[model samples]
Target: MNTVEWSETLLLDFPPMDEVHHTFVDLLALAQAAPDETLPQAWSAVIDHTVRHFGNEDDWMRRTRFAAADNHIMQHKVVLNVMREGLGLARAGNMAAVREMAGELAVWFAKHTQTLDAALALHMRSVQSDAPARRTNRANEHPVSAP
Candidate 1:
């Protein structure tokens, strides 16, 4: 499996988002390493984490009135649908599909984090600075080094 290697380059400098993203990377690794008999459950956990992760970002977009909201949400939806399909295939004993998806996801995840998610994190910070009361105070919670 082509696993995503979490690195300083992936940091968004936002605690909540970074925490979720770290969990995402870990979950993806779990899915990638899952044995054939346990792939279904591992993949399911990834799906669950992904839904929550996407939902959190969607909420941030809605709150901040992000200009690329529609496109971002659409991307999330499409990816989730494909993941769900892969889960189904895995349940049907097509573990290869899930493994393949995990590899593709490693590639997709690095690109997505560098682009879309990075933008969102910046936007959220901008929103926080522009309206301190509207944004939750999570910036100091994770203490990750910024890129």
Candidate 2:
């Protein structure tokens, strides 16, 4: 069972995403090493954080019109569902399932960040390059109405 940790290799060079990834890794570590009594809470925290993490990425994909947004979002949905199921198993006193899920997540997250997230990060940077201009254009076209 590999313990996930924040490392140079995990740095995506995208601060917001990197920060979220770091938090995720830390939470996963906590869950993996937690005492049996603490495992459920720790696992739940990971699930909650994952929901937000995946939601943000999914939103980014949708907003940026990423070419593979559907596939990427579907993967997130599937993984989250599995994690949620693990949570249920954990609550029912299946600590082994929770521990196994944590290990699986460590592997999945490494690949996910390196590939799908890496692509999304590149797309986000591309969109950011034009964001200021787009915002200015929108502001001009739709001036704020005074209250």
Name the top lDDT candidate. 2
lDDT (10s digit) by residue, model 2, range 43-136:
9999999999999999888867899999999999999999999989988999998898899899999999999999888888778777777767
Error of 2 at 127 (Å): 0.6
- The 0-to-1 C-alpha lDDT of every candidate, in the order given, reads 0.87, 0.88
The global Cα lDDT (0 to 1) of model 2 is 0.88
For each of the candidates, the C-alpha root-mean-square deviation to the true structure, in angstroms, is 6.5, 3.7
lDDT measured at residue 121 in model 1 versus the true structure, 0 to 100: 90
Off by over 4 Å in 1: 133-147
What residue pairs are clashing in model 2? none
lDDT of 1 at 147: 20
Candidate 2 regions with alpha-carbon error over 4 angstroms: 135-147
Write one digit per residue (lDDT tens) for candidate 1, span 66-146: 999999999999999999999999999999978999999989988999999999999888776665433335555543222
lDDT of 1 at 97: 78
Q: What is the lDDT of residue 87 in candidate 2?
A: 87
